[model samples]
Target: MKKLNKNQVYGFIAIAVLSLGVVGCKATSSVEKTEDKTVPEMFAGATKDTLNSGVISWKTYFKDAYLQSLIETALKNNQELNITMQEIEISKSEIKARNGEYLPFVGVGAGASVDKVARFTNIGAMEATTEIKPGKEMPEPLKDFKLGVYANWEIDIWKKLRNGKKAAVNRYLSSVEGKNFMVTNLVAEIANSYYELLALDNQLEIINQNIEIQSNALEIVKIQKDAARVTELAVKKFEAEVFKTKSLQFEVLQKIVETENRINFLVGRYPQHVDRSTGTFNDMVPNVVSAGIPSQLLSNRPDIRQAEFELAASKLDVKSAKARFYPSLGISAGIGYRAFDPGYLFKPESLLYSIAGDLMAPLINRNAIKASYNTANAKQIQAVYKYEQTILNSYIEVANQVSKISNLEKSYSLRTKQVEALTNSVSISNELFRSARADYMEVLLTQRDALESKFDLVDTKMQQLNAMVNIYRALGGGWN
Candidate 1:
């Protein structure tokens, strides 16, 4: 083969460089550049204290031992949490796969083949005339044997492969943050359900007490009817009131069962009795929640952090996709031994080796690359919007909970007073009915009102507890 002269080599190099210049220009389009919105300095109508309750550990924030145990079990056994953990592992594997793409690929192999040529052909005519030895001609059909190691590497001059690996790394981090977000929700759910169970227990107890009170009043009406002081209609009204109050206990009991099963499902266990202390449910006070500053949510909330990581990954994806329009340099090399006879494969004369490099760019039919570039840009924008939305939602949630807690406090206080007044009125109504001054309907109404007020107080306390847990979750607590 004739070798190229210096001028020809230089000319070839110049042409190749020119071709790269023509092909490497990237497809351009407009994309919006956005920055995340700054959160408020403080939550709406909230204190400026920087003591964020979200920083508190779940074990420390939840003082109940039983609740802590349930949360611990769920963290270890919850099905959704376990599934999320596997997703994180899958993301990590993707990072490894992407990382490997930026590095060299190597392999070793062996192969055998047989080839034959017609004597009439030009290369076949030469082969028949040539002699491998003084009297021996080349074989008519040749057997080939080869063993070799080969390597390929793509030079990342444009950082395309590196950017892809970086994107994968960011996605892996996003998956981890997603797991943490799930943990926050799981902890909050179990705590809320636990409180609901306590509230149901208290409501049931109140129903049973009301039933006893109504039954005693019914006995009084029966005695009065026998004494000719009241009609049988009054006696029937008292009995019906007692039966109605008794039925309420069954409704509350069913709710208790369903609630317990919900909690059991979250804890990743079969339905069973949840161990709890119901006697102090009324006395249990909600923990003081700190909203801290709205700005803290960016770092504290897992969903926000997850979205941030996803946004970062999407930006890298755009870079990687954009780089696809640039020239890529690849090198491949092989070293091996080949021989017509298996016994001669290891001989020095049978050795062979080759190396080559190629530089390529998409010169035509680049619609796929353009589509990918546009899709990447769109995703990046989507990620930006998602990040902003998560932050806004988190801030609003905390604000709403802060306002709810304050209103519930006032409502609980008022309801407590109302319950006390109604309890006294029920007793007074009974006294007046015995003296024939008040009607049986008034006594029944007073008893019903007092019972309802007590139930409302329990529900209010449950809501207050739920708000506390919710705010903690909104602030991105519990995962730590």
Candidate 2:
């Protein structure tokens, strides 16, 4: 073999290094363009600076033990969330598939063929195949046996393969963020439902208590009627009021069952009892939220992060498409031994080898390349706007939740006072009915007002609870 001249060795090394640099640049560019978009304004809030208290851990965030258990169970079994887990697995497989393209494809092939040609054909009349054995001579038109290994690779001069691989990687990461966003929404939903269940329980208990109060008033009226302090009409009216309370109690009970089922569905379980604490909902406190700087939201919110990844992936696809317009280089080689006899297959003289390099660029039929490039550009623009829209959405969500948290807290507190006053009126009006100073009409109105106040109080409490849940979700909690 002739030794390569010094200049030839240097040229070869330069080409190799240049090819490697091209591949590296394509991979690096995929995710780096995200820095171009403007930062968004964070949700409207009193605190523009975020309180980066240690990251939220659900175990610690939910001090309520029952709530913690419910959340843990939901994470394990929630159907939609579990399905997203499978989607992430699919994305990971896609990444592997794309990454594989940068490397060579190797395969082996084996074949044996025998054929008889017609004597009328020109080649058939001139040639015949023969095999020599110890005691036998084989004659045929031709019988060939072949075995070989082959490999093919595209030298990524324009880094199309590497860019495609990076795009796959970005998409995989986007899927993960998508799952996280789902997780945040899921946790918020469960928390909201849990709070509603508690509110329902509280309302039911209030109804039962009011029933007892109304029943006592009815008994008093009956006694007064027998003693001639009031007429039988008053007793009938009081009795009706007591019956109405009983009816409402059943309505609340039905609500409790339905709420249980709703929660059961979310937890991915059969309709069954949900362990709960029906303690005073009045004691509930809305979790405080600091609507961190808009920039921080870019990282904290999974939806935003997912959008960023998709944007990065789109840009990479554009680069890959553009690369199609550039020249592509490929190299392949094959080395093996072949012979008519199996014994001679490995002999040096029987060796057959081939190597080739190719450079190709689209010349006439570049419509495909043009179409791809145009589509990639369109998609890249779409991703840019989508990324911007996500930022806007995140900001709006945080702002709305913050307003809800503040306004609802104030509204809930005032409602608590309204309920307190109405509750006292119910007691005073009933006591007066027994003394004949207040009539059945007054008693009935007061009873109705008290019940309404209780319902309103529960509704307000639900809002406060929901605000807390929403604020947490808006701040990008629960994924961790």
Candidate 3:
């Protein structure tokens, strides 16, 4: 065995002392472990069907071809969706940047410089007297040239760099989930707006029909006034009813234009007539909705998943921050050749190489490290609360929609019967007025009631369709 040199023994002692210092250093303050709230097993007042509509493809769930086409266009061209896609790409770039931090950086470099020293100085006097050969002297006004490969690396002894990279990976996944959540919302908004446009079309049709009926009643009133069976006031009342109904049609027409424009905006284009089947608007029945178990929402809802990922990333951030209190290790090295003249640069006599290691720990003025650690802990807690809130919000939305669907179904059925009775009453009142058995006011009242009832029926059906779309959104459907 060879004997140990004093320099080597001293170097080992210095490393031991630094390692001890690292072990002795304590975090300024300890952080509490993060805890997340649990989700409910079942929704309130909901049957556990185990078959969530959220898993169904949007194309299959929404059978209307026009609506399907609109959603497809929005997914590709909607400005908001496109913007989120760019955010995802940005997050991807962050992941790459983080991944590069823990790895060694190696590069090559070359440089040239000229230097001169006074003759009275120590180096100048030595150069003047030194001989390169039997009669040769050192060169004056020296020109130095050098080339070398160099490397620098931070040793991740406490996993700080790796944790940062993992956190970035989680954030990238969170951004993707954010895009999925947007898709779900965009699809629902377009669908609800499409249904609203159809309702307006139906309302316009109803107004036109009512106008014709009122005009005919006005004519009958004129005949009665000629026969002296009714006064001129009765004729005027019928004429006013016809005018009012005619005005309503224009209002509905304006709404149709506005709703169509809204759909066009969502489709990322200029306003144009939206293609839809108004003929089936009244005949269309809302599909049955089934809400699966509440626990399934954790996996079904993209917002919830997004929050979960953010929580994971925040936890990793806390670990990375805490590592700041510990010692860091780094290594740097370079090897090449240099000489006064370029011709001697590659010679063995001119060879040069150096390597070194650094060990550092935060021993004083560590308030910044402490603050960063505390901030990371706070963000982790915030993420936990956000995760729980998303789950709760998803459950509440599904519950409300389920309740609304049941109530709206009952309301629609009753409104249909009311419309039927009011429609028949209009005919009865007209016949009685012609026979002088009912007052003129009675006929006008019956017509007004019938029109209002029919309007209510259409409005109820629209609400039913809207509830269906909203529940699908709340359950996190449409993204897939």
User: Which lDDT value does model 2 have at 35?
Assistant: 38
**CA deviation > 4 Å runs, candidate 2:** 1-43, 129-141, 227-236
Q: What's the residue-level lDDT of 74 in candidate 3?
A: 93
For model 1, how does the per-residue alpha-carbon lDDT over 142-236 read when each residue is reduced to its tens digit? 88899999999999988999999999999999999999999999999999999999999989888988988998999899999999998999998
TM-score of each: 0.96, 0.86, 0.94
Over 1-480, each residue of candidate 3 has an lDDT whose tens digit, in order, gives 999999999999788767757653687565555655576777777886799988999999999999999999999899989999999999999999998899998999898998898999999999899987879888888789998899999999889999999999999999999999999999999999999999998998889889888888899999999999999999999988998898888889999999999999999999998999757577998878788888888898999999999999999999899898888889999999888889999999889999999878887788898899999998988888888888888889999999999999999999999999999999999999999999999999999999999999999999999999999999889999
Q: Order the candidates by lDDT, highest first — what do you get?
A: 1, 3, 2
Model 1, stretches more than 4 Å misplaced? Answer: 1-4, 116-126
For candidate 2, the 10 contiguous residues with the lowest summed lDDT are 24-33
- What is residue 399's positional error in candidate 3, in angstroms? 0.7
Question: In candidate 3, which residue ranges exceed 4 Å CA deviation?
Answer: 1-24, 130-134
